[model samples]
Target: MYHDCTQVLDSDATTYPDDPPVELAPHTTFEKDGYRVTELGFGTHSGTHIDAPSHTEPDGRTLDSFPIETFVFDAVLVDCRGKAAREPIDRTDLPKSTGGDLLVFHTGWDAHWGTDAYFDHPYLSAEAARWCADNGYHVAIDALNVDPTPTEGAGDVSGNAKDKPEGVPAHHALLGTDHLIVENLTNLDGLPEQFTLDAFPLSVSDADGSPVRAVAEFQP
Candidate 1:
């Protein structure tokens, strides 16, 4: 069995405030004596998306350069719900002997999707991203990000006022290592605490990221 990880993009779908919102345009209407056709415009990272290394690394590989095999692999789930903000999940959080190349985090943040709480949610720490990088965990979180708010600061430090003030250390740690970062996943709570995950994105050439259709499967 499989569960879709892709978000249904609509007028209400969440996106980076700086990016242009998703919009649908009709190129040819069925009633206009033509075939049904539509044009979609949105940021690459608009929904349940995968961030390629190039998303953060200037010299990193693009989505088209990624090997097809990279999209298919074994996976392990690490559930860290109820954990403190910006918790660092080291090797201990993972299975003792996971054979899969992919590591997925189930933080139960999907419940807050479409709400302001979702954007303000906590994320994995830089150390957690480092751990995944060092251990060869190909993919990362399904939550907002992997950084926390600044512990000591009166004014916003990061340029983006809407983003967390902790900076993009998580992006640097994970994306810097050429690991794929999947964000804004939902329905992870329905999955078992531990299971196999499969995630794939559209093979868009030269794209920094693309919405993925991720899924988890386990024997009942």
Candidate 2:
């Protein structure tokens, strides 16, 4: 059986500070004697989503441009649970078992969901991001943005400094490559330390990103 690793998107789901929060409007309701339907008004990158190359790279591929095979691949999990604020995930933090096409980081940070702590959690370093890109890993993440938090004197304006360093090293290192990234994952704690991860985004043409329904299956 497969256990879901994606976070459920709801009106109350936590969103990035600058991103618009999810909104649900009723187009029709079954209780109102109409078709059971609802219209969602939110960003494409909302909730447990995959960021395509186009999301950060100017000439990168969009949601529909990715091959089906990119969505299905062998995966491994890396647990980085007890790090303090602003700590970067370097090469040594990863486990030896992680040699798959996909790498999922189970930081146990998802427990901070809906609070300010989640948004300000630790993230990957530029070296780590570069390592993944150079080594051919497809995905990476914790529960928050990969960029560091902006310091008081820093000239950065992306509002990612809370989790990253002076510059957006992680983004440049990771998204600069062809690898896709999955962010804001939850329920990873229930999964085994290692498992087969299956994460695929919706095939929305021209979309820079899409929310994914990710899952993991492990054999005892």
Candidate 3:
């Protein structure tokens, strides 16, 4: 059985407060032209998208640089919604021997999508990020960001800090030469502990990130 783990990309959909709002223009409506076609516009990281190392690291490889095999792998899901807002989840939350498995963290933050609370969701600890990297696990999460909401720039965040560090410690910790981060995932509650994860990005040349149709298929 396969569970779709992607968010709907639309004008009304919730997006990271810092990213551009999704927009579309139909240039080929049947009323005017032959058929219907749309020109979509949104930030690369908008909606259910995967972040490449280049998203954080200046010298990191872009999404197009990764081999096709890196986008498919066995994965394990962890429930850590019990973690508090504005706090890091404890490293003990992860299973041992995560080697070669994608780790998808279900924070249940998707419940807050389209609300003020979405911006204040909990995040992975820098230590946890490092642990995943150290154990060779590519990471994905169902949160607006892997890092805590930024200190500034995101508008109307409940606890916007004037001095919130611009630094994304968790992103920095998790991103490597070929790291993958899938943000704003939903429907995680129905997935089994183990599944086959396929999260391939568009081959936009030198793209920092791309929207992904992420999914999980469990064994019978």
Candidate 3 stretches with Cα past 4 Å from truth are 97-100, 151-166
Candidates in order, TM-scores: namely 0.82, 0.87, 0.90
Number of backbone collisions per candidate, in order?
A: 0, 11, 0
Question: Which has the higher TM-score value, candidate number 1 or candidate number 3?
Answer: 3
Weakest 10 consecutive residues of candidate 3 by summed lDDT? 154-163
Candidate 1, residue 207: the lDDT equals: 88
Cα lDDT for residue 102, candidate 1: 74
Residue range 150-203, candidate 3, lDDT tens digits = 634343443544324356877887776355788898889878788888888888
Ranking by TM-score: 3, 2, 1
Scored against the true structure, residue 10 in model 3 reaches a CA lDDT of: 84
* lDDT (0 to 1) per candidate: 0.69, 0.74, 0.80
Report the lDDT of model 2 for residue 84.
Answer: 61
- Specify the poorest-scoring 10-residue window by lDDT in model 2: 151-160
User: Which has the higher lDDT value, candidate number 1 or candidate number 3?
Assistant: 3
Candidate with the greatest TM-score versus the true structure: 3
Off by over 4 Å in 2: 96-98, 149-167
